[model samples]
Target: MAFREGGAIGTALGFYLIVVSILSIGIGPDLAILSKIAPGVLWGTLLLSALLSVDRIFHNDYEDGTLEVIALGPLPLELVAVAKATAHWISTAIPLVLMAPVLGMFLNLPAHGFWVLVVSMLAGTPAVSFLGAVGAGLTLGLGRGGQLLSLLILPLYIPVLIFGISTMDAVLVGPGSFSTSFAILAALSLATVVLTPFAAAAALRMNLQ
Candidate 1:
């Protein structure tokens, strides 16, 4: 509603199409084709869906004064940045989780992979949000920051997205060794967990001034 009310019609539409297509995938004569295509489409949907909300973080809050108070707060600006970015992620990615059953239906994903998608998104979206914070921080006050934010964030997120979807795909394959990909996703998320706060806080502080 906010996305629509805010008038970013194109983005809202993209979000809708993604949700619809993922949910509406038919499951009948194309079981083999579905298995082959499911992993890529599921992964692609996650990436595209997440990208929609990254720019709104700093861009919206910066316009208001909330970002300033947060930057100047005593609890360490980076920590605040991490928290803020996480909140942004929650807003965007949680909805995707709720929508996962739809994507799962299309893939005919097993019960195990169904839960895996949930866990992977949980592990994965933090990387997206925080790294996006870096991009957002860099472009916090710029005239055309959204596209630049994508350029900055997409590279950082590839590994996170890959490992996450890879885990799901691996599950689809021969007995699925998810530990390795899962570990990489965890590592990436953890690394971002450590670093993005400070980076985002710096961007917030810079924008504040």
Candidate 2:
């Protein structure tokens, strides 16, 4: 409700799309340079875009006391955490994934790398939402803790960024190369998705206590 009412979902999507579009233009029509950097630029933009929306994961609910009621309800707080993170991924990350191919084309990304980009993003971005939930939970009462949330969350995202780009970079070498990176990225996302809900639930419990 808060995300819809506040337009945060649209803002994050629009912001990253425009930023990537501007980057594609600002870098000029040099396909060689754009293609060379496309993986890094696109992945970085996705990370930043996810960061902008993560704060809202728990902020409004926490403020309005809904989170406390949810905590006391039959649904476990950990499951609530998972649900919020999943909703964030659907609302925020999926749009980014859809736009990535078109943005990749705009940056003159190689056809081979295009599918790799989409696959890597699909595999890796769920971690952003899951981990961001922990960050948002930790910073719940900080009063506009978006900046602090980014600081707390961005470091944890480093592995995702590294492997996400490596997935594309390794594509130039051989199938085995990108596959290995994508596997690690998938592992990371899976681990975060499985574990961070508990962590976030703990954090929310601390805040509530």
Candidate 3:
């Protein structure tokens, strides 16, 4: 599927960047530039990859009747949305986290930077999933929902993206600090927790009726 392909491209690109960095041992400034900017690059690529993968969250279910049953189930729709998004986070986001070590190493990240990437991504990807749900819900019935999805989710992801990058960036080049960025990442995740479900549920209801 296109959604899976998008995620694959993202994962592939991240690793490709790493390989390029290593191969550039004496060829150019590739490793140096990657080291200086790798955290942001890593998080940004992961976010994009995860975002692209979310397009399938409800597309098939809605086209069939599964979403209808889910909607009418005893449990709240928001909870269902949360569950689906959590699954998505596990599949897409977890891979990115696992790959961070390789990426950090390629970027010449500080010895401790890998830890920072893992912790921050663990907290951040859920938010990406949560927010992507809203986008998915909004574009649920559109033929070109994927395009709209990117437009909607990108702005919402900025906060998480910023904090995630900042946390790892600090590990690589700053004062060895993380409290502030980590708090911001947690806050962004919390904000999505509060805001996305209402929109996702409302969109689903509209599409159903």
Candidate 4:
């Protein structure tokens, strides 16, 4: 399904590139300023780009009755939630992560920080997809739920964003070790991967009823 929805992936990737390009232009030619803010900007834009398609995670399935059939199958809804979120991670987050290096160049991201930025994003973006599934499931079938979904999910994304940037900063010029922050970011992703499916599954059940 994710592969079939090429436009959605393109939209997310385009959003990531366009936002980074605009920010680079807006920041003027100051490489110093650009590098200083690069980590935050990259992390923030990636999260927003991921948000662009999050509402569709379950919305299409729900609308087409595929969700009902999946829910009734022998597999648990929590695993279904996991499957959907994993597909989202592959379709959305991986593309964004792959593009981060190119975008990071626009932001004048440090050479040393490139590897850290990629690693941090890889560690943290799963939380974005998994936690987003919860909001997607909660807002399923609602009118104009995208705005509410943003409200509900962006807060949950903060820790991931913060740790992600911190991981970059630590690698670039840090008071703390890179492993420390990266571990926290990875832990956040793991926690969401383990827990949010249950929450998303419950939300789906409520909506299905």
Tell me the tens digit of each residue's lDDT in model 4 across 1-209: 34324557889999999999998998899999999999999999999999998998998788889889888889899998998999999988998999999888888888988888888899999999999999999999697899999999999899998899888888887888899999999999999999999999999999999
**Residue 29 accuracy (lDDT) in model 2:** 92
Clashing pairs in 2: none
Ranking by lDDT: 4, 2, 3, 1
In order, the Cα lDDT scores of the candidates are 0.71, 0.88, 0.76, 0.91
Score candidate 2 by TM-score against the native: 0.93
Which 10 residues in a row give candidate 3 its minimum summed lDDT?
1-10
Ranking by TM-score: 4, 2, 3, 1
List the candidate 1 regions with Cα displacement exceeding 4 Å.
1-29, 110-112
Give the distance in Å from residue 55's predicted Cα in candidate 2 to where it truly belongs: 0.5
| Candidate 2 local lDDT, 1-209, one digit each (tens) | 22433557788888888999999889899999998888889999989988998988888888888887887889998988988899898888989888888888888888988788888999999999999999999999787788889889999999999999888888954545877898999999999999999999999999998
What is the clash count for each candidate, in the order shown? 1, 0, 0, 0
* lDDT tens per residue, model 1, 1-209: 12211423246346845664645454444766765666666666777667777777677668877666655667777766766677766666666665765666766666666778888878887887788778888898898887887788887878987888788877767566788888889899889988887887777777777
Clash pairs, candidate 1, are 78-197
How many clashes does the backbone of model 3 have?
A: 0
Tell me the lDDT of model 4 at 20: 90
Superior by TM-score: candidate 1 or candidate 3 = 3
Q: Which candidate number would show the highest lDDT if scored against the true structure? A: 4
Error of 1 at 101 (Å): 2.4
The TM-score obtained by model 4 is 0.97
